[model samples]
Target: MAANDFYKTPSDAVTAVNSIYFLLNAGSNAVQTPYNTLFNTGMNFMGDDENPGPGATNPDVRSQSVLGHASTGLRVLQIWQQHYSGIKKANIAIEKIPGIDFGANTKLRERLIGEAKFLRALYYFNLVRLYGGVPLILKDLSTLEEAHSKPRRNTVQEVYAQIEKDLIEASTVLDPIAGGADAGRATAGAAKALLAKVYLTQRKWENAILKANEVITGPYGYNLVQNYAEVFLPIYKNGPEHIFSAQFKSVSQGQGNNQAPRSVLTGVPGIVGSYADQVVFYSVPDATKPGGVDKFFSVYKLYSKKDKRRDVTFVTKFKSPTNGNWYGRLNDPAIPGDSVPFFNKYWDPANVSNLAESGANVPIIRFSEVLLILAEAENELNGPTGIAYTNINKVRRRAGLDDLTEGLSQHQFRDSLYLERRLEFVFEYQRWFDLIRERDAAGNGILESSLHKVGKTNASAKHYLFPIPQQEIDLNPNLEQNPGWL
Candidate 1:
């Protein structure tokens, strides 16, 4: 039957073809979620508490604080396994392309290969950064025998080199912009951007800036959104300025919906009375969680007032459907307090789905982030100057703000750029990167006493990269562990 042929012929298996790429992106209920530092701003669970995400929702995957629970072990393993699975799928697609093919449409074939390579490189990049040098498994494992023996940790240099190779290959094969039904596919610009990041991590300053400039100036269909808010509008998903984003389309709640929805779903009209701390906040939180204890709304308002992205990225009481006036955090959780503020930024209230089922595709990588990267990388490479300031100001200009012509000293420039990144990209997983990048050649990233109030973290070599999972170390004698692990 025709249906049987579709399943048997690799060329006809379009669903299988797409599934190969989705493995890297499919959201899982992993433990030690970014909710602690990234998703959450109010909660103070860091160096002291080892366990991170004890599911405020699920009991099974909950670990007290990510201290040393076994389930957390599984969750961490899941992160590795799932991403590797995606990488495997990509490698398989690359290998099988020549043999069992996707018709004679040469362009489609090249695009598919480009996208697969992009995903493969990304998966490896994520792994290598987390575990230092991991085994570079490029070939598709067919037999169980090959699978068991082939998995070996590669050297850090080797892994970085592989990432570079794959990204370059993808760049050559991909189009600048995916169009029509192919918009979600990886593009040449995306490949180039990821390569820029890879270069930045390796401290190859000139190359990082050059590659970033290429994307900024090149014709891959990216330009800054006129309004900071427009950048994240779900109505115009994958807006003009987005270089690459995790695309989510809901066919009544299918793939792409993520924890992105929690900002609103979890903020439903209710008293934050868990602790008698009824800070019914109607605004975005700063260093302190606006609604939770040890929370402060003053910093949020003060910092955000001048930040252009403040209004667009948040649904402050000032922009709410009601009086549109700023309401600070409510101090009492018992009464659904008089002046309650909630974050409506990461949610579409129209979404009637359950808390975990929201479909606001998280913006993991975007043109705005690259702009900041170039600004910082250029500052590092060229020191404080008008040239680097131009890039930095472009970011600020969008947030309804002015350029930093005044803070021209090298130290001041560095401090200003890093703080701008922190304030602009709040809860977007950039804070950790900021701390990492602050390290000098000697590896010191100390927060001056002034900034310690946010989360004072002193960086050492042990933290440059996370420790290799002990399980993997025990199972594979070849895998050496990172420093500072038991």
Candidate 2:
């Protein structure tokens, strides 16, 4: 097993493993994570909703961008160093899991090992997916000698191969569903769900469909929540549909990190009472889409009015200010009042208990997405026409959109599904990868052969795979830069 202090003891291994969850946060304008540079950060710079923090010019933000570009800046090195530090810790826990005593309980040992492997795979997958083929170091390479001696990029196939393998192993060990206190932990369904996604990205449509279907139809203890908006309530932590969500606790100053309370950071800027320099931990008001009720209203189709999820998923302007919640547009004059959008989804008027305190969990992998993957892969396997409507309708039904009553050709169905995907799962960090897979080697889809002209779609350029941080390259000459940049 990995010989490291953090790798010693089952408890120590668990603590180290838990730390990896912190890496899952999406929207934090705090100085620590240069939110502006990351596409996932909803607001880039303006701290205002419309404008995220200024781009990479913000040192932390800039460094994050440079990690992909050819720039040999220290910020790039810092991000790389820190990321590996977390990766290394998680890797060590995975390695040591088997060696530790998980007691006579066979399931306990298997579950812990599975948990560690899932975390290890998740951390490495994030790195590999972000920065093409990285040094696939599976152990703690602590010293200068070890760091400098680490090998160059492993093939991208090999990187994904490892991810696929870990997830498969995790599926074997993780509990199917333990419930409540254990819901947030890795589950057999989570591994299967992630494996299906990886397979889809790899274009192994058959496997993706099979795995996704297994999760969708199998006994994983998940189902569609009755009310979509109520689904976001911390009170609904036990919702059957959520396969796995990053858990947070309600402290006076909320405990835990991640997208669970990210809305607070993005939606609620520092108020007169709150300090500007405040590291608003859990929740924030949306500067761009200000009111909890107003933004929810925006989701309504001007004409297609029957969508039940509209009220279920978001609190629209039509809904009256309940006991505590009120609806109003973002009042920011910088962006015209008409243009300013409020975020209605994922807020609790009951949260007036405290703006910062929250217990909301972020759905990292919900069964709904698994259902979508299953439908997508099944349709793709059948050339989109044979069973296309069946696959598309499941997600559409959930989103309050009408199903395609008549069968459409393969190409049309593909576009229909893609649009549904975008609407059903906005701001969930799935779009970028989804587009990447649908596109060709050139980073565009076959029928529509061009990446969406968005921020970082440099498929031709290796910027798609961020650089192996300048410092790491400098230290280990074996490391090679992706094609486009230095």
Candidate 3:
């Protein structure tokens, strides 16, 4: 622990662990900084799917996204620092809680430790996936001397091993779910689901399948909500589909943040009657907006007319009161040719708060993802078996799509599974990581053909791993940069 007297009782231990979840949503400065939104902005823009929205004031974010590479950019640096800050908090709780004995029943103490370990693993998981192997700091630096002794980066494999160990231990000690005030805390099911994803990222198909099955069959009471659109509604948050989400409250800007800037329709500068504040978070757009600077690619063109998810996923049509005309993201008589679509997934019409402060929980993992994992892992193990087909069909049926073709080869199933994930998780900050993990058959480059298809020609072998932030390198002379950045 950072201080020996920091955690003396079980309540103190629980409070410290709870603080980690708060850091995930609200930043150190609270109102001005929403850590999760900023982190997702960096991830979403870096990918090929989203573009910088019109009138975007953040030059650092815009340059990093459109140019496809910026080692020392502001958002990149902030993301690195925020993640490490989270890791530091998690480390403190993990190190201190286990040693303190709480009278008779040790279950409370042990569960708190499990929660800390789960959060620590999650912080490390994000670090490994983004910057590859980062410094694996598991304990708190209690003094300035300990902190000044800079640590070197560990191997990617070593980081994964640590993450795996933490999650495995967490699953055993944590409860399946929490109620009342502790509703959003980590659960045994969350640990299993995350561990399953870790295995999937490592391409350990059998292990991924095993962990996913435990999550699916476990008595956590998770299920796919009937309506795809309703699943993201603030009322339905942490409901049936939710395995894990970063909880937010709409009381104040300092208290909570949302995905509005990246998902809303923004344009029309300085208009008094503008509906901007009603729909979006900030006046300045961060990523994509409908009918403005950077807009979404036409996923509507790819989706069937019968597909329900298309409407839920992206905004295609809306009424524009400014011009007293109707507008459509793709093609409509009232809108101009340049207008493109924006994400509608995070829209909360009921949220009439100032600056569109939303209470909507940001989903990290859902039951649908578990089903997809089961399908993908099963198909990889054996070419489109009955189990794989059945699970994939469940997702498709909800989206108003037909069942997948029955006789796909192993390679074909892999491609189909990737496409499914793309459509399912659009605008949720999953695309970049998905592309990073995907490898070509020749193993020459990551997302080579996929990036090219999306006109992300700036993407190259060097992009397989993000450069270790320059600020971190400067602070710690021992830290080495990722290969291409060197």
Best by TM-score: 3
lDDT tens digits by residue: candidate 2, 345-380? 344445533434446655667777776776667666
TM-score, cand. 1 vs. native: 0.78
Error of 2 at 346 (Å): 4.0
Ranking by lDDT: 3, 1, 2
lDDT of 2 at 103: 67
For candidate 2, give the lDDT of residue 298: 26
> Model 3, stretches more than 4 Å misplaced?
27-35, 267-297, 317-339, 353-355, 441-446
Candidate number with the higher lDDT (1 or 2) = 1
Q: Against the unseen true structure, what C-alpha lDDT does each candidate score?
A: 0.59, 0.56, 0.74
Candidate 2 stretches greater than 4 Å from native: 1-9, 25-39, 42-83, 143-145, 252-339, 385-388, 440-463
Candidate 1 C-alpha lDDT tens digits along 399-472: 77877877577677877876787667654544444454465434465323213333323433555455566676
Best by lDDT: 3
> TM-score for all predictions?
0.78, 0.76, 0.88
Per residue, candidate 3 scores C-alpha lDDT tens digits across 157-185 of 99999999999999999999876787788
Q: Name the weakest run of 10 consecutive residues (lDDT summed) in model 3.
A: 272-281
